[model samples]
Target: MTETTKQPIRVALVDDYDVVLTGLAHMFDRYRDRIVICEIDANAELSDQVDIVLYDSFAQPESDRQELAALVRNPRASRVVVYTWNFQPELVESARTQGTHGYLSKTLPARELVAALEAVHAGERVVSEPPSKRVGSAPGLDWPGRHEGFTERESEILALITQGKSNAEVAALTYLSVNTIKSYIREIYRRIGAASRTQAVLWGVAHGFSPDHHRIDHWLGGP
Candidate 1:
């Protein structure tokens, strides 16, 4: 929702890569009225007042966790969206479980990233549905041809994980309990043998399945 010259949402970007930060800055520049983007490439001091935190996994692992913990501690966070370059399902899952706002790919299109920010700000979980498979583990695991084993709902969850959507978001979108979504996703991993998000996305791509927002809307049944 764009307003004509409205005040921007205060935002912070924490990442180790300058290129990623710059790209994000440029993206937000267009939404300058919607996102202020106060801090770029920050290592710490994730404020409570900001609308959201666009953080990198490598830049501040512990610190990022601490920031998340703090946000939940108050139970009144503005919002926190992670823009991760190195994908890991466990880490992303952990962040989702920990109450971070959303997760997205660092390499995702600026439009997608912006959409994620707006979604998170609106308090919606925004993740891209990648694909579904038998599920596998290890960063090195090669994808199999049969991802058809995962259920329609389970596949929907996997797609979100691949796109960096939080479990909470899955719950809302699917109208399932947070714990239920978590359980399904864990099962997807076990079935696919994937230990992380990057591997999952790669596997989804290798397999015939590809995540699309429409897939979730069309298949991940909800009210």
Candidate 2:
């Protein structure tokens, strides 16, 4: 329970196995006053009784992930937390794009879970730190910032494409319309003399896109 005296935050707990769910439920029962675990159900629809959801790994089939994404898209679906032992960088990256509020490994301590939940409810992403650096932080993609190559916007959009983000997702991240992203992508292709995303990516790799590389144009100076 939160000693801070805020209204109790509703949470839903889900696990297919009764033992796991009961143990977690009992643990959360101690904090019911501040972080109420409203319902403990196995394989049940979780839309009611909670503002946030803590899902287990058994809930990770493709259909289930889509369901979770839908939950995150709800008007009240503000916080979607996945508490699973099976954490993958690829899955975490994908889930982040889907708007999950947090992704925690199940083996974390009780206090860590509470802190994660608190952060999520506080309108923050709850990915564990030191955070994995798979997505952003690609310095080469800051094209505009570099007199060396692309405009900042172009570098970013191109980086996501190379990392395999869909145009729709790239649009969401950049706050650009999907067609706008397409236009930027086309512009990138034209600048690179590449006709398609694949060729552009290959051109990027040939030039430079990471810590270990730098583009040829920076040295060759626009042939």
Score candidate 1 by lDDT. Answer: 0.55
What candidate 2 gets wrong by more than 4 Å, as runs, is: 1-4, 47-49, 62-64, 129-223
lDDT of 1 by residue, 58-172 (tens): 3234234666666555432467676554344666676788877787765565556667788787779865443234322212111222245764446556655555667787665
Candidate number with greatest lDDT: 2
Please report, in order, the local distance difference test score of every candidate based on alpha carbons. 0.55, 0.59
Model 2 is weakest, by summed lDDT over 10 consecutive residues, at 214-223
Cα lDDT of candidate 2 equals 0.59
Can you give the lDDT of residue 196 in candidate 1?
A: 80
TM-score of structure candidate 1:
0.47
lDDT of 2 by residue, 134-155 (tens): 3222211122214446754576
Superposed model 1: Cα runs more than 4 Å off: 1-6, 16-23, 59-64, 71-77, 130-223
